[model samples]
Target: MQQNAPFELLSQLRSEAIALAAQGLTYSTQSAGTKNIAYVVNGVNFYCEATDVKEVSVCENLMIVPQTKAWMRGLVNSKGVLYSVTDLSLFAGYGRAIQAKKGHLLLLAEEAVQSSILVNRVIGFRYFNESDEMSSLDDKQEALDGLSAFVDKGYRADGQDWYRLNVSKLLASEQFREVQ
Candidate 1:
């Protein structure tokens, strides 16, 4: 045996363990640039992969977690589990002057909390393998709160351009606060 063969064997074992763990993780199929992922709530699109999402199931109704306060738009039952729903269109600025309605609900169990983002209806899912996104949102619109990071730019809708959404922040914003 070689002089350092024992250490090499140990290193090989560690590499195998890492590979095994990685194999356990799964990533979704990336969509073509600007291919179109129907809006769950107007401009707000759901973007998730194995890295942050495992599986997505349709919810009949998610129970409202009142503690979430204004951000909470009642709740829906997701696979027997309750998820707090947020009027995503209203939460994403798409509802600027429009009113939110009862439509489809997106159950996001990514991190921190499992939130329900209410959308009009899930048209479909999109994938982006290689794409161009904006550097960042303009500082002038800092108060926009639910601003996107310009990920996957050039997405057009009705001759208009759009960007990807930030799921986490949308769930944490004060957009739900009413004029009390």
Candidate 2:
């Protein structure tokens, strides 16, 4: 029994190391422009920095607030956190996004200003490569009017123009903070 003690300890340690590695979540740190999540709102496809997005889920039990802007969809309790929901399309001057039978919500990172924006559909995850040619909307003359200031940049991939949605800028904008 004494002779087997060292071997037993080694086996137990190896098993624990394997289990811990399996349970740990690893994130990629490649030079590619940052992992992004693609989503659509009001037929406009946009991608958001994955780090700035906290969670995405189907919105439920949303309580409407009266006498507020049409873009404001009210508040919702998601996983014990109350989030102020907004219609991204309408706020961006792209017309209202009609909620489907099952509406989708993308919760922003918990910053000083945090809220969930309604999205039409999630296009899954994609890497925005750093080498991809990017251009500012102002230079490209593709201004989105009210939303131009919130767009970080634009790039083309898969024959489609994908805009980087800047949540920080949007949250800091006066239009967003005036939710009274």
Candidate 3:
């Protein structure tokens, strides 16, 4: 056993070095350029800056608020923080989201917003090069109709167009602020 001690230490150091290198590679890939968190709302694909989302969790334990807008799902207490929840499908005029057994809650990163949006499903992080961006999405009028005000850019990847939703602008818009 004593004779193998040095070899064991070397093997452990090699493993640790490999692990650290992999972590650094992932960080470089994610931080070197922008990545988007893709999600589906009413069967439409949408993207938001990964940095804009602070957390993603299952939609559960929602406490309905009284006399609010129809699209306002209610309040959700997550990690001891109260967030106003909105049904993205309904809010975007795409109709109500299908009552799935489990939906995703995208918690915004902004401290002042204190809001989360419910989506049909989350498609995970997607990376798009600058060449993938499209200046105009004229063919996707139906999907952009209600979300146009919040979406200023679009990208195509994996044979689909992903509309980027500016969560900051959406949260700051007068229409969203008028939630009575």
Candidate 4:
């Protein structure tokens, strides 16, 4: 009877392990698919990888810096950490953001950059499959003229085109690095 008891417990444990493995496989496959959270800046749709954004906050109490470019809005202190805020609309040649005080700030995930960009609003997430990707933006080139260097890809979803912003490339660019 004791020997049978041990064998039964082992069988139960093996089944549990098998069930857990199957669940893990399903979760991994679901997360591996492409999804993007789109945000709007001056009426244009833009998105970056989920890992590229650290946090989002409302624009408030920004300390203006001296002698910086127009696009460089100012510095903001968030939770004891200082972040340089760039006005995406102004930087992308879309003119000044009308609702500067009522805008949203996207804190970048870069450790060394410690910067964020101000946008008009956040439009929420939208999952895009491979079929939605556009190889070229030839027809809409003028629309993204200022951001062409940082935009690597585009997607069509919900009757609008979403541009993928490469945060790493934008942070490393000379134009972005030089605030003056």
Compose the digit string of candidate 3's lDDT tens values, residues 21-69.
Answer: 8888322332356878999987788989999999998888889888988
Give the alpha carbon lDDT tens digit for every residue of 85-170 in model 1.
66655554554422334466556656466665556766666644443343444642433334444232324334433455555544
Considering every candidate listed, which one attains the maximal lDDT?
3
What TM-score number comes out for model 1? 0.49
* After superposition, candidate 2 runs with Cα above 4 Å error: 1-33, 139-143
Candidate 4 worst ten-residue window by lDDT? 25-34
TM-scores of the candidates in the order shown: 0.49, 0.76, 0.79, 0.80
Q: What is the C-alpha lDDT of each candidate?
A: 0.50, 0.77, 0.85, 0.84
Lowest-sum lDDT 10-residue window in model 2: 25-34
- What's model 2's TM-score? 0.76
Error of 1 at 151 (Å): 7.2
Candidate 1 steric clashes? 13
Each model's backbone clash number: 13, 0, 0, 0
Model 4 residue 85 CA deviation in Å = 0.4
Q: What range of 10 consecutive residues in model 1 has the weakest lDDT sum? A: 149-158
Q: Which lDDT tens digits does candidate 4 get at residues 133-180? A: 898887877778688889998989668899998989999999998899
